[model samples]
Target: MFILLFSAVLAESLVEIVNSDPTSSWVAIDYPREVITLAKMRAMLGDETEVDGLETMEYVEPDGVPTSFDARQQWPGKLFAVRNQQSCGSCWAHATSEAVGDRFAIKGCSKGVLSVQDLVSCDKNDNGCNGGSGPRAMSYAQSRGITTETCLPYVSGNGRVPSCPSKCKNNSTITRYKTQNNPTFTVANVQQELMNNGPLYFRFTVYSDFMNYKSGVYQHKSGKQEGGHAVLLVGWGVENGVKYWLCQNSWGPSWGERGFFKILRGNNHCDSEKGFWAGSVKC
Candidate 1:
C-alpha cells in the first residue's frame, strides 16, 4: 500500500511527499513551477533584467579515465563545504570560494578555509551571491585579489551590507592556469585534472527530487527539473563495471548518504567523460 500527497508552497515550488511507512517519508517537486513563480515575482517587481545574464550551459559527458596530476593526493584534511544560494542564485560565488578554500588547504599552511561570505559581500562582478560564472569570479579574484577568511567571516542571514571588508592580506597558495567558460567540461578532462590537480567546481540544474536523493545510481526524475547551483568534484571510479564520479554536495552530512552523490561519469551531464578538473598550487 502506497500513498502520495502534493502541496504548493508560498515560494511557488510544488512539493509532493510520499509516506512509505509509519516513519519513513519522501518528497518530490515541480521544478518548472518554481521557476515560473520566481519569474513572475521578478516581473511584478520589474527585476526581470536581474536574471538576464543567467545562461544554461550545454551538457556533455567525458570520454576516458580522468586523471589528476597535482602533488596533493587528496583535498585538505579540512575541506570547507559551502551552501550554494539556490533560489537566491549565488552559485558563482559559492563555487569560486569553495575552490579557493581547497586551494588554500593544499598550500600545507594553516589549512586556510576562506569564507564564502567575503566573496558574497565583496565581489562586484556578479550579483553578490546570485548566479555568476566561475571563470568570471576567478578573473575578479585575480584582478582585485581575495582576503583571508580571518579578516572577513561569512554571514548566513539575508540583508546587504553597505560597505565591503577592507582587509587585504593575501595568503592563498593556489594559482589559476586558464579558465574556460564552456557550458560544460568533459569527464575525461575532469578526471585527468583531478589526477593532476586536487578538486574541481561544477554547476548543474538540480531537480527538486534531488533533495530526496537517498542512495544508489541517480536518474533524472520524471517530469522534474530542479536545477541546482554548484557542486564539487571529489573523486571518480568504476563500480561493478559502471563508471561513476563521486560528487561532494553541500547539503550537509545528513543528506544523500553523508552528503555525497555518484553520477554517471563521462555522461553528457555537465561535460565530463574523463572528469572535470581544477588545479591547486603546491606550497
Candidate 2:
C-alpha cells in the first residue's frame, strides 16, 4: 500500500502516458520531452473578449440524454474542417472562419470554407500570423466580409506577416461571409446553440499534457501550463459518464482525436466552456 501510494504520487509529478485510445486515432507527443517552442505553442485566443464578465443570459440545463452529436456527421461535406495552421498562431483566424462557415451551411447557404488567410492578412485590428482574437475576426467578417481559400490561400506557414491585400485574386468569384456579434455563454447554453447555430469560435488554455492528448475526454491532469489557444466548438456529448464538448482543432487531422477532441464539460474545464462568442452568419 505504501509503495503504491508513493508510485501514484510520483506519477502525478510527471507527465503520464495518455495514449490509451480505444479507436487508436490519437498521435501522441510527450510534450515536455519534445519541447515545442513558446512561439509555436502560442496560438491565438489570448485576445478573446471577457465573456465571464459580460451580462450573460441565465442557462438552465434542460432534459436530455447523455449522447453524442457530431457536427461533421450532421452536415457531412458542408461542415468546416480540422485544418493545420502550420507553426503560426493564427488559430483565431481559423476558428473564426470555420465557425461562420458552419453557420452558412446551417442556414442552407452554399457550402464554402472561409479563408483564414484573408483574416490573417487583412484584419488590421489583429496580429496576422503572430496572434489575434477570435471575436475580432468575427467583427472583421461582419464589417468588410472575408473571401474564400481559392481567392487568398494561407501564406502564414512561410512565417511572416504580409501586407493586407488590397484585392482578392478572384474578386468576382470570391464568396464572402459576414457575421454579427453575440454574447458568450457557458456549456449550459451550448447544447441548443450548437444544434441551431452550427459551430462556435471558442478559446481555452493549453497545458503541457494537452500535447499528449490523443483520445478520451480531456481534462487538465498533470502538466505545465502552456498558454491560450483558440478552437471551434461544434457540438456536445457524453462518453463514459463524462459530459464533453466536441471541439474541432486547427492542428490538422493528425492531432487530437482525428483533429477533434471531446473535452470535459459543464465546469468550464480549461476555460473552454467559460465564454465563447455566439453569432449570426448573414445568409
Candidate 3:
C-alpha cells in the first residue's frame, strides 16, 4: 500500500520536473526584494501545511549581506554532503543515506559513511530507486539494518538499481532524534534551528531552470511551478558582509562551485516559513 503511494508521488514529481520550463531566463531582482516576496508568500501559505513537524521560532528580518563565517560550523567536524538525485526519482534514498551518514558520525566514528545502494537494493517495503518517505526509510534502516560504504560502495549511477555487493554486514548506527512535516515552516525559524542543530532535511519545488542556477539570488521564471523535491539545509557561512546560508547541493563537486551554493540567510527562500525544513541527529 505504501509502495503504491510512493510510486504515484514519484511519477507525478518526475513529470512536473520534466514538463516545467526553466527559470534561468527570468530577470534578476535585487536580493532583498526576492527574499521579501518569498517570505510573504510563505507566511500567507502558513507553516502547518508546509511541512510535517515544523516548530515555530522567532522571526528575523532579511539582510541582503552574506555572513563571513562558515555555516557548516553548526555541525562542527561533521562531514556532511548532499547526494544528487540526478535523473532518478530517488530523493528518499538520498535523504536516508545522508541521515544515516550523520548518525554514524555522531557515534564518534571516523569513516561514518553508509551506502544508499544497500537501502536501494535491500529495502523491499518501499519504492526502490524512487521517492520514499524519510521516516519510512529510517524505520527500514532501524529494522533490517545497514552497512558501511567500504562494505558496499555506491556506484556513481542514477535511475537504475545497481547490483548489491556480496558481503552484507548488519551494522546500523543511525538514531533519529526528531522528524517534522511543516508545509508552512518559516525561514527565520528554519535558520535558527539549523544554527542551533547540526543539519536539516528539506523539500523544495524544483524547476528545470534550477539545474542551471550557478549563482546570484533566484526569482520565479515562467512555467516554474514547484518541480523538484529535494533534501538539504544551511551548512553555515558569511559572504559579502551579508550573512549567507551555505547550501549543500548533491549535484557533485563540479556542478556548482564544488557542489555547493550560498543564499542570503533569514530570507524567505532559505528560511523555514516557506517550505519543509526539519533538523536531525546531532554530531
Between candidates 2 and 3, which one is better according to lDDT?
A: 2
Q: Output the number of the TM-score-best candidate.
A: 2
Winner of 2 and 3 under TM-score:
2
lDDT of 3 by residue, 72-100 (tens): 55346665665544545555556556655
At residue 59, give the lDDT of candidate 1: 35
lDDT per residue, candidate 1, 1-283, as tens digits? 1112232342223233322222222233343442333332222110111222434234344455433222223644646654433233444555666665675565554336555555666667665634455555666555554555555555532434335645433443432222222223343355556554456666555554455455544444432554444566667655555556676665446556466676654454433232232434444
Per-prediction TM-score to the true structure, in the order listed: 0.63, 0.81, 0.58
lDDT of each: 0.47, 0.70, 0.47
Query: Residue 12, candidate 3: how far off, in angstroms?
Result: 27
| Model 2 agreement with the true structure over 1-283: per-residue lDDT tens digits | 6754653444334333444434332334433322332344554334344445544344345556336777788888878667888767788888888888778877888547778888888899888776777667777878877778877888886567777776676555555666766555555666767776788888887876676576768877655676778888877777777777789888777666778887877676776656776578766
Model 1's alpha-carbon lDDT is 0.47
The number of clashing residue pairs in each candidate reads 50, 0, 40
Candidate 2 — worst ten consecutive residues by lDDT sum? 30-39
